[model samples]
Target: MKEDYLDIKTPEYVAIQFQIAGLGSRAAAFIIDQALLMLVNILSIVVLYFVMVGMEPLPVFLSHSSFPVAIVIIGLFIINWGYFFFFEFFSGGRTLGKKIVGIRVIQENGHSITLLASFIRNLIRLIDSLPTAYFLGIIMIFFHPKHKRLGDLVAGTIVVHERKAKKKKLTPIEKEINLRGLSQNNLLLDEWTLKSFTSKDWKLVSTYANRFTQLPLKERNQLTKQIADILLPKTGLDSAGKTERELEDMILIIYLILKDEWEFEL
Candidate 1:
């Protein structure tokens, strides 16, 4: 079966692919979020009532004044908005629902979404829910090529699944890397240098190092040079005038360094 993929040539000039999440998964995720929100709202009102007017009958507390009602209204606004914002920005683009559904948001260009982008997308969610229960948003997602809603289009983001799970068995290239005794100790990379690399960098390096050995000579050289062009400069190492083997070795050294910091998850 043919699967739809969201392929982005990142600003870093590396090609990456993610599976595009479709309407069914996205709708389920939203339903989960709304259910959680409702539960929270009810709990909050109950807790506030108990604390503010203990043991008082619910009818009496409500009849006393508008203060409790007003507070509840304000609380609703904060909880609804803050829930999505905090999670999306800090949790790498997954709300609890999205996490459960195994999908996350990212920029159109294949980067982790920025804080501003997160804010914009969620803010526009109000419009996406327009006229009813996401009537407009569902239409946009169904018809659009990328399944993007107005929020996603405006914020330049899309939801996608994580990459295929990494294999447990060591491939031939991995075995060769182990045999060659290539590691961070062989080459120098400082703590600060390592900190500069993001998870995306690790993905690029790992993909290149693992696959280069499997290709034909010409293809291997081309792939090596393309990857080298992107990653080596970050390590204060230049690939210019270096042979393909040397480049491959440098990348392995980087992989060893990055391995200490990153677990291959997505």
Candidate 2:
């Protein structure tokens, strides 16, 4: 069964869901990558220190070899750069840890990004990580509405939650409620008829409801009756059959018209 009453309209709702998924996956991957890189750097430094100390016993060897140090630095740069390229280019925006955690990065409009887009985004991280004391990436995350980093912006991508499976069940009586007749076009809702609503659309309806209530009681009742008349034919219900409670029920029915299940009842 589907919970058709739930609606997500604002960007904040989307952003929050994205963040929850990212923290569990993308963020974990990043932390592991950084830890591994730091370990490699430390190990390189230790090996260089021992090599230099051993060379002190031989002046000729010490005087001739800054090349090894330069080579090690170059190797480190190549290793780090290649690591980023390998993951971003071939793995569909996931590193080993991200894959384990179940999240994939995709374009803002929801498409697979190209290798060049990924490269440009990560390469520019050098500038974003600047000032020798602070990370500009964190600042960018805080300032951007979508919490995107420079890489995300350049790649035109956003991290999103992988869709999870939903459990559904139905009752025997609910199976007999035919819902083929329900569709958005068939439901007629007007300002006054939705006055007592308390769902997501309630805010929208409440504005008009308040306005209608400001009029004289007789005028308000006449307006409500007029709205009911307009809705009756569209809903395929008789005038005598419909009641005030059906007004709110109609809103619920209209909202769920597109859902897979036909179990909704008043």
Candidate 3:
């Protein structure tokens, strides 16, 4: 099949693209999920059987009056449906199967799947799995342009491969800091003194340091001085008699140090 893409725009009109997942990948993911569900269901049935009947013979289990078979049916129903609903609802639209397959369910508008949407989709999965397997669902997916089964079409969701995260290019401040070597030794920040700066302080510095490049020249200087004034005292440094450029360098320096402590590379 030709590679199909979904193009969407955010509220800000930033366009994004996603590749639609096709039958092969979706089927693989479903098989994985079904395998896991089968395991859980078997375990649950065994536990319930023992709990209801004890170690007693089949007569206890077979005794219609003593056996609550409806409970077993209900438990199995919940597990079969709940597995998909709970995982899709809470796991950002990816079950373990979908996550491993690198695909996720999302709304047609490209947002995360909503709770109601997840419920409706998985509820319709009963119909999708008609005639022993997902025969109808498979046919629908193979024929649908977006590869949506009835569940997805009904729920206004699509399965799409996750977009690989683009590496963030260095901000202007980062480039300048790299050029000037904004390291701990050069900045002379005492280890103990730096640790005193809290997450809130990091937010103050990071906001300005990372976003300074995007502001207009005059506004950038004003915000830099404002952020510098708030942060300097925490680091046992003052912005006294410093140029806005120098103040910006100091903020970027703090940013570099604190980011190391707080942020992990992804």
Taking the tens digit of each residue's C-alpha lDDT, what string does model 1 give over 1-266? 35579878866788898999888889998899989999999999889877777745556646657867787899998899889989988999999999999999999888888999999999999999999999999999988888899999999999898776877998787788888878778888788888898989999888876776777999988888988888888888889999988898888888878887886555
lDDT tens readout by residue for model 2, 98-127: 666676666665556577777777787676
Which candidate model has the greater lDDT, 2 or 3? 3
**lDDT for position 63 in model 1:** 68
Instruction: Give the clash count for model 2.
Output: 0
Q: Against the unseen true structure, what C-alpha lDDT does each candidate score?
A: 0.86, 0.56, 0.87
What RMSD value applies to candidate 1? 11.8
TM-scores, in order shown?
A: 0.62, 0.46, 0.65
Residue runs of model 1 more than 4 Å from their true location after superposition: 55-64, 168-266
Q: Candidate 3: minimum summed lDDT over ten consecutive residues — where? A: 58-67
Those runs of model 2 whose alpha carbons end farther than 4 Å from true positions after fitting are 1-28, 42-64, 100-102, 132-134, 167-266
lDDT per residue (tens digit) for residues 1-266 in model 3: 58999999999999999999999999999999989999998998888767756746555546675356777788889988998899998999999999999999999999999999999999999999998789999999999999999999999999999999989998687776788777655476777887888888877777776777788999999888888888888788889999987887788877888888877631
Clashes of each: 0, 0, 0
